[model samples]
Target: MMTGLHLVIARNNYVKKLMGLSIFQVSVIMLYVSMGKVHGGTAPVYVMGENGEPDLGVVYSSPVPHVLMLTAIVVGVATMALGLAIVVRIKETYGTIEDDEVIEKDRQEEEALADR
Candidate 1:
């Protein structure tokens, strides 16, 4: 029962940490997206003119920030997925993913090995 309780707590902590990281990443992406806006500029799309030609006077904010942010988000997602996969493996291998418990268990193993 005690081990079960500890497992529950460890899972909760991992969830909290994951949520915190997600929020932080979202805020950063939002900042980048916001920077892509210009006070008086329009989107980078072509406007049709009477002659079926594109209007040449449309001002647009540079799409650099928006594009960069998109790339960052893609990379971030991939990295986050990899990290979570590793964490899951660790939890399975060690039987617990809690930092304190893992460290304590490691020390116990080291002492036991030394005593042999």
Candidate 2:
């Protein structure tokens, strides 16, 4: 995650920023999945006691985090696709995906317009 954050901020290429964002997102998902797992945990099946109440001594892990991560994975894919699409549009408009170059071009265009 730290590496991704560094790349996202330090890189000048728009594609590298997207790649860093993807890495950070994957690391977060992995962290959540690992946290949801227990050492000796089993599936979340409940056992019934003789008194008809659910047994409370089970060491089953909750499925909520895993389920939520599944949704997150889907959303992450969609987000990546959208980011790539935007980058494509930026490249089309600016003819370069380098952040510095794009900004320089915009500034130059502004200067030219000002002189006119």
Model 1 clash pairs are none
TM-score for candidate 1: 0.68
Task: Compose the digit string of candidate 1's lDDT tens values, residues 1-115.
Answer: 3333444355545544555566667677788877776655555575766888655465455688888888988987887787788778878877886767778889999999999
TM-score of each: 0.68, 0.81
lDDT of each: 0.69, 0.88
- What does candidate 2's lDDT look like per residue over 25-112, in tens digits? 8999889987886545556576676888665666556698889999999999999999999999999999999999999999999999
Off by over 4 Å in 2: 39-43, 46-59
Worst 10 residues of 1 by lDDT: 1-10
True-structure lDDT of candidate 1: 0.69
Winning model by lDDT: 2
